[model samples]
Target: MKKTKILILSAMLVSTLFSCQKLVEIKETDLIAGDVALKTITNNEQGIIGAYAAMNVEMGILLNAVFADEVVTADFYNAATVHEWQYTSTDISIRDSYTAFNLYYRIIDRVNRVLAALPTATAANATDEAKRSRLRGEALFLRAFCHFELYRYYSNSAVGTDLAMAYMETPSLQPQARITVAPYFQKLKADLAAAKPLLPTDFSGTNVYRATQAAASALQARTALYLKEWNDAVTFSTEYINAVPLASRANFPGIWTDANSSETAFKLSRTASLGGRIGSLWRATSASASNIGGITWTISQKLWNMYDQANDIRFSSYAKDEPLLVGSGRKYTRLITKYAGTAYGTAAENVADAKVFRTAEMYLIRAEARAENNDLVGAAADLNALRAARINGYTPVVLASKDAAISAIMDERFKELAYEGHRFWDLKRRNLPVVRITADLPQVNAATTLPAGNFRFLLPIPNAEIQANPVIQQNPGYTN
Candidate 1:
């Protein structure tokens, strides 16, 4: 007789419904037995795909922008609280935080279940074994990726200090205590190390949506950068860069519209039927209808001035100038069209594929790592390569010191990876101050500058998590 038991893992409500473009849907009733459900190659594939779908949501993307200085709200709402830096533990947008926490963990739970089941699951042939190995690697990658995201938000350390987060490895109902920052990173690295050899150099299909060997390396580089492992960061980033070359200036604009660009290492595929509201948050209903999205998060002029508008392709491709009435019938021109939604040639559809990783990021990572390691010349070369690709008639920047090179890399990251969610974390990781230019918008409070060591930089652990798990501790600033 087959043994069956119901497992409740934390606060996550594990539903059996699974669907993706490449993977077949798995129904709840069909997956009654855990062993039977994940007993086949197809079932395991669907399980991992479902985890990817859950991980690729809009809440984290929106929050990353709102909480940072990348964009500001034009209208009043609970999201505006995050924009103005006035959010608390009980704020409505805090629900978004809870959603992110739960979503990532849900991914972890799914991945763990798949990994556990894969050993016992029947594989008919060598092809099946290969698929099983790739799937296992993908699951491990997802597990590490999700945990890293959670660590960035929940953990307090800029460096790997003794900060703790609930590190769940197994699919169990037992309450888990938070692990320290170093141990959490060790686990993340271990997972990535195991995954690297198992994943393929390229995915089977035309879509680069799934995690590949390059994706694993890119993520490892990013993790290394966060951990201050400069040499390791450079090595992994270089490996990824060698595999995936940067998109030329002509092809850069197409990457956003076209899903199958060479520069995109890993991105979540979004269709009209199953899409996100990221475009709606950043884009207006029409070019003329400013602030129509309810929360019109316009780009700051400070960020706008950073680009060489005439020479740089990114400026034209990423930003749009629109007129906004500031005060007393005065017209103020603002850059409001960074993300003009997913209908490339047609009207805006308010839908876009969530960009997780790209080759350009690898270049930036390598450049930063080189700079950190005092290899300023090497850093400048890497930076110039990206600049030469993006900018017309590009002049290579010559830096006198390591500081100047580091600063240039930071600026490049801000311009290149603006809305894709790197700004806030970049500032946090470097211990740099978040100085918002509120003079442009008088509606913003005077206290706009968030110092490097401010407690508010670390988001509060969601109230739900706190209430559910007594072992979990809230971040220093937030009160339960």
Candidate 2:
């Protein structure tokens, strides 16, 4: 019996993942039997690296910015296509949607391959067996994390019946139907549960880049928030918080600068050499000698104003008033400097490690979960703690009601997670609209009000996948 080369999508790259570079395979088969390809502990460990390379969160970050009100196209040129919200029409903003869809599944496929090879792969000693087990856990974690990402982006809502992604465990070319939203998450939870014990409790050199017990818990905390499993959300977030406290005021800026990994639960290793920078998404590729970046996107003035510029540390940490000389004059535009690469302030290298999960987010999760659970005092404390760390001379406020606490938590999330990519989905999770600042509308040149439950919120399956698989269904409103 021959194995099916399960293409993650209609056309997917069979790229080599050593040293984090892509090399296309031109072979009759995209397979080497599991035992041969991953015959040893080293082989299995290295196989997981490919999954990490293919896991690109930057695509989702791009979608979160362009589709929602967090950003607007620069003054003259709209670098990317402005989104068209109608179900049947081509939307430029969401053009990256299919790319995101394709990427997550590609990650899943890479993970599954690692997993499929594990049982038969040789581990010569107890140390090797321990390492192998950890690899298996990390593979499972990646699968759960990627599936959760797809579920949030593609599902209309988290309701049980809403159509979500096909959760693939075993690799196969057989066509798969979309699973419902509920089971999708349940499967994700099961994978995480299986992954946790096999994973290490600590973060070491390269393991810091790989998923650990902390990272798995972070996923659980976040998933609980989405499912409104308030108690679990609070419990899991508190678990991460207890382990890694918030980065201090002095150290807070360093997290963005790649100066330190103070409260980082997990991050993707990106470098000038290995090259998976996220900065180019907001910055133009080429810039003249006089200017730093030909900034393609800027934080919406509305978002910019929300920052306490002088008082809030995030104001400087997330962006800068990038001064550019314009025709014998100087003008300052707010540039998203979050991904300013390893060169930091100078050189505009536009690359940096992608911080996938941080402890600060746990605080926010605890806050949101507490709010929804009507633990108003606890929610306020969590919210206040995060704000106090990020802001100078911070003053705490009481959230008189659960609604007010949730609202405040939303604002905190915006300020905390701006360019790091949570804005759009945060609103979508709450069934809230993408309410843009009136002035922000013309800057984007597209729908300013994306009401909750709109068809556009659910990204259509990439045409490649739809045309490739007979059993697949296009998302509810999108046409083939």
Candidate 3:
């Protein structure tokens, strides 16, 4: 492992949904030098906790909501860079192109630090040793998870020649070149596989906030689904689904409101004190009956029309429609309520826990994999199972062919996982064009269709990274 000459005053260790928060800080400058910060098992535990806090699933959701078809922005928002798809590799604004390069890499650096320190750290007894094992598992999973996220945006194509992400396992100040996706995924799977046995299966209460065996399986299922590893996708997703079944209709809305952890396999706690609320990512910033105009970025009319607003549980789980007084008449605007702040404490509006891994997604993953593997009946069963769970009176449907099953699964994912950051990637993975309805696009003056294989499909490598690391390669169709 390359030793890093680093200066981290506090947490470089924050993570996202399904991990922890708050890294252990030291009073002195050399917190990371010669294993000063993590010289004990307790220190290692705090370090890993800090790594988990660094991740924010909202990062992906916020970017995709604007760039993808789920949202339509008005001219008033002035988010042309991202909303209008005018982003360059060099545009570094918060609302510009979607790239969490520095953030994810920072997490990888902290996780690597924990891994390096875990070996020599003092363990007083077997209990401490057991804790060490769990810490190691969590650290490995986080490192792989960060790399996977980087690949999700950075890799245009996960091919041998296409530049993917620099799969980091060591901490260093030296610049590194991007590697091919094939090897990157290879190492990603290797890390998950290694950590699987070491992690615990009990993902109850606060345990779900950490990296559990179930969370690792969830990540595996998602990774395989993207890479077209049908059998593995089914295998890993099944593991997660078996551990955490789909939420019942009565419990569905509660998942988003943080009222209950029904089908949630992993979620990051979003304390109001942290001020990490993302409900305002859109124009309205917060959604409600009184603040109808607060629904700034109206939910895409096309996508909204697809939902059974009267019956389907998800229609209400994600958003609501309120009458808007426009001119003398009235018009209704859809408000995204998925991030509706918790009743536990409503001091903050639009603040909700990042439920990263829901069992509902596993069912979809298994369905997609089964369909791709030519198991139409199995795919239909999985699809219908999730539908039955979400909708009031869903009846099973027969898929005539593989294409039909895949199409159904894709649409199901669109509605089931809307605004959770899956829409754009699902379309991209399937090589399908992003087709937004005319009603949603015209109001925002946004493009109706982002053709498949467009350069914008892959976020450009950050210009800062490209400049600092001369060896790093930028994605094609971007400027330095």
- Candidate 1 error regions (>4 Å): 1-31, 75-78, 97-99, 156-161, 203-207, 284-295, 322-338, 342-348, 440-444
By TM-score, is 1 or 3 better?
Answer: 3
lDDT of 3 by residue, 1-480 (tens): 123423232224333322433223324564456467789998989888898898877879977777788886542456666666678877755324366787899999998999999989999889998899899999999988888888887773645566778888889999898888788888989999998888989988999899899999999999988788889999999999888988889988888778898887678888767966767665343244443334357678878888887789999888776445354232345567788774322466667888888998999999999998899989999999998887787778999999889888888988988888888777877888888778776445567788998888788888778878999988889877
Model 3 CA RMSD to the hidden true structure, in angstroms: 9.9
Model 1 residue 332 distance off true place after TM-score fit, in angstroms: 6.5
Q: lDDT per prediction?
A: 0.76, 0.79, 0.80
TM-score of 3: 0.89
Query: What is the C-alpha lDDT profile of model 2 across 230-323, one tens digit per residue?
Result: 9999999998999788988899888876778888879998865665667888775434455555666787877888988898888888887754
After TM-score superposition, what is the CA distance of residue 224 in candidate 1 from its true location, in Å? 0.4
Each candidate structure's TM-score, on Cα atoms with residue i matched to residue i, is 0.87, 0.88, 0.89
lDDT of 3 at 370: 92
Model 3 clashing-pair count: 18
Candidate 1 residue-wise lDDT, 1-480, digit = tens? 122233443213343322252246445664467688798888898998898888754665666677767775554344556665666767777766434677788889999999999887788788888799989899999999999888777763645566757777889877677778888888888999999899888843644788889889999999988888899999999998888889888888777665346677788876656655457666544443343333356676678788999999998877766434444241334544544555333444565667788888999999999998899889999999999999999998887799899899999999998888778778888888888775534364446777897776777777887888887777778888
Q: Give the candidate order by descending lDDT.
A: 3, 2, 1
Better of 1 and 2 by TM-score: 2
Error of 3 at 228 (Å): 0.8
Q: Tell me how many clashing residue pairs each candidate has.
A: 0, 1, 18
Query: Native-vs-model 2 lDDT?
Result: 0.79
